[model samples]
Target chain A: MERIKPSLQLKDDIDLHISGWIVQRIGWVLLLLLLIAASLGVFGTGWLSAGHVAGKNGTVSFERIARFETPMKLVVQIEKADGDIEIRIPRSYLDCMEIDKIVPEPATQKAAGGSAIYTFDAEAESTITFYLMPESTGSIHTELTIDNTNFPIAHFIFP
Target chain B: MNPVVRGVAVYLFLLVVFRIMGKRSLSESTTFDFVLLLIISEVTQQALVGQDYSLTGAFILITTLISLDLIFSLIKEKFHLFGKIAEGVPLIVVDQGKPLTKRMRKCKVSEEDILEAARFHFGLEKMEQIRYAILEKDGSISIVPEKEKASIK
Candidate 1:
């Protein structure tokens, strides 16, 4: 038998620890950057082929924007500044389901002084759109959530 | 509380819960381990980020978890008896260049695993070349080659 040395040994070094920490944090930072990049791509493009826009009671509303059939979730973070958001579903987007009849609880609700959060889920390879109208006539910033998928087909614009 | 702080809290709570479950909660875990891990995440998630989420709530839970881990690791390190109980001691599968088939069967280690370990570890393609083989405490197989090759005579 050859003289065998034991394998387990603890590693130590101030530089190594600092370098390892940097490497670990870099991975997380890259992941966050990728998410932000994908989101920007989705929010900057228009893929929902069909949509409807309505101006009613001092509010301009757009809704029923559907993506080509695919797993899709659209979350809009409407900033505090303006009116109520009115989302409508285009009949073409609802092939087998009736959007008007079925009401889902909003996944999240965060608002203060003219801001609202909305989240919508749609089947993969299906079309979905949302309408945003300010309760008062004013411009507002918008933030959209795309979760884990690629960018949405259409970019959201707030005015 | 900041998200980092919240994460620490949820982690601690899970450590305590899992420790209470047993050392097998981490080692020798089967399908039950996966289910428990999933449920623990869900439960801790709720506690960490509920409507009234607080850093204090999270820190307390996290401290509890780290404490449990430290305690268990300490027990395993300080007490040989507890270590053996927690992590089963290594079983001898081959002794003096002879396979102990009974011991292998008792330890649930297959002949193939032993052969694979020998081939990969010591580059020994034939079992005859191995003087001893042991299934280690950490579920790995170790090989000791025949001493005759080392004899200068």
Candidate 2:
């Protein structure tokens, strides 16, 4: 038996074409749009806690958003009619988010119900900012208590 | 994020991105292209594991990526049309000592590239000495010398 050698000839059988089908092109366009939107932080969660005033006692406001392994800022403002007021935050929030920095460092801190309560003394009015980073992706919820008033804050972390 | 999921998603994303970029992107590489590739890998690494630096996370991601690649290859083998779509067919850029200028232009393969392949493989200095030049699927060129010239050699 003799082995046959394969022919080495250039044949003009089909026209040269490099592009794919129109549907595939459309898919590529959609994918590009999604990537652009994500880069602009459009998919990430953003929430603002309604301003709560304790009947002239003080005003507390904070904005919350969650991002995976990205630092987040939580700003809290308080206006006290009388003496220094203390703020208590759930410890569970600390577990999910690592405190990277705190503006006007807390006057005192204590552990409560799987949460770290940071106390800040506000003589008249003061604003405290907390820089935090999400350890993982998921829903992280915690309660913000100011002058015995509770505000539940929830953040949805993106992966 | 789950490392396995991240690995699969990254693999698919890269596949589509490269496909959309077209074959020339891989065929032609400059010094800047090399740097861009390194930067892309660095960015992909950050997205793959996020903040998880554990050995288990790395292992899972590696396994997932390899598994996905293997599955894709198997599917390519099973389906001829899919394989052709994924890995383009080889094209002829030269016939009977003549360059197929239209096909060559469409494939982004210049006459110089065919001549270079001819010189490297057959030691034939001129295009007239070559019978056929194939632009292979992997972007390499294949040269077949003219019958008379090959017989003489």
Candidate 3:
């Protein structure tokens, strides 16, 4: 075939073409990994991120993985309480999240010793649910003390 | 999160995501691509503003994104390699009536795509009637017809 030379003088950078293809392929792999992690609750809610902590008093349940601005819940299941029940939640947790509502409202709440002590009327058994809206994105670790029992909980919030 | 940080993060993430998706992924060659673009913008809006619906939030995000773009443009202008890496260059796929197989394959371009561009752009009927077909930086094909052929309007 007789070659018709093109007058177009476009820069043919050898390295750019090779690097472009290589980079895109790598990006595909990374995107796939991201999707897998997301599906597994690394970014939000999944089996891998549903966490719970148990104490003699009861078991505390919450999402270990969550997203900023996405509403989630922290539940405390109480066993037999002789009288008024007091649960101490850390100020750190309060600082990171805003409690929207509490199921079975507490009788009174006091802020002391860098924690909030919420006193609730004792029932043989009951569940306290704190609807939480994360204030920001980061890892938060705190302990909920119920009747001298400490239940540790941690959460990782994504933006 | 800080508005500036949110804006910057979304900007860079979207840039990387589009780059990873490659040039053709959202080129609007089809109607579905247009719909995908709309969906992407909707999702991006929620992430950018979060819960804040005030004009201040909007202003801050707009300023932050525009500033980032200006800074990146300046940097790319200063660095040739960076610009090429950030935005790909136009490559000639059909050169002198022959398809350049290597670049075409690397770019995920098919001969049919080039022929389609040829027919749509210049009404050229055959590969021989197209002198050169360059895939532009923005994922569109520009065809140069042979001087004697494909002059049909």
Candidate 4:
């Protein structure tokens, strides 16, 4: 019968030491620093959740400047807290003559100068957002400057 | 402040700090872990940006961090010994239904914790019911149950 010995490797010992230093000690310390720094500064920007996605029945902000060949599409979403909120989309925002869609039968329209205002009522409790036609035309700015003081517009951009 | 310069300094510091935090912090981090993270950022922020911040200071800090990481990664990749050095090996806490008392104490894990992990993982009431138990490098418990085939059949 031969006796067997379990030989210990020097390289293994060195590797374990380095691993302990990096993964357990230094790595942990650095990570803690990062979480804190990012939460307060630039790194924090990527980690925190944006507020615009939360809550309902709020205003929206959009801005686009028209230039050459491609016309811009104006999409608007207006919301309110009460029972019913009304919106008047000015004809200047879209090319109504070229529009093709399932037009609502009960929708009221009124002529305002050379432009027309399309009137529609939305449920107050839930948010109501609608799309304007021509899909692309001149840049439009719809300011949801409704009377109630509490509801503020939430600004967002799509790129 | 110039947004570009501020952005680069801040970004570089965070890159080093987060890399050091390891994968575990992102995985099962507790409240204490979060606090430690916060403090590190506060310290680094002062160094990376502000009136007292110096170009030489930031350069030294960032360079040291990058060099250490690169060296560690290269060693860990090129050789098994270096890899082990860079990452700790799993410690065996239980073998053949017996607890390794020495290893358990070294890991700061009590017999109760070992038993609990074993019981939860293997549905074992006693340590004897476990064939093997290892404390992994990631601070997780791994278990091999006794005669799993027998129980299945």
The numbered model that scores best in lDDT is: 3
What class would a CAPRI assessor give candidate 3's docking?
medium
Over the true interface, candidate 2 deviates by an RMSD, in Å, of 10.3
Better of 3 and 4 by TM-score: 3
Q: All models: lDDT?
A: 0.46, 0.70, 0.86, 0.49
- Tens digit of per-residue lDDT, candidate 4, span A80-133: 545334344435443421333322321565665544445455554433333222
- Candidate 3 structure quality by residue, lDDT tens digits, B51-85: 88899999999999999999999999999878888
Candidate 2's C-alpha runs over 4 A off are A1-28, A31-35, A43-66, A77-85, A90-95, A111-116, A123-125, A138-156, B93-133, B141-153
TM-score of each: 0.34, 0.69, 0.91, 0.34
- Scored against the true structure, residue B25 in model 2 reaches a CA lDDT of 53
Instruction: Name the DockQ score for candidate 2.
Output: 0.23
Q: Candidate 4 i-RMS (Å)?
A: 9.9
Highest DockQ model number: 3
- Residue A108, candidate 4: alpha-carbon lDDT: 61
Compared with the true structure, model 3 gives a TM-score of 0.91
lDDT string for model 1 (A81-157, tens) is 22333333332223322222213454444543342333444332222333222222122223222332122222223
Q: What level of docking quality does candidate 2 show? A: acceptable
Give the poorly placed runs of model 3, Cα more than 4 Å off: A1-7, B151-153
lDDT tens digits by residue: candidate 4, B83-152:
5533456666676677877556545556776777776776677777777676666766777777853265
The model with the greater lDDT, 2 or 4, is 2
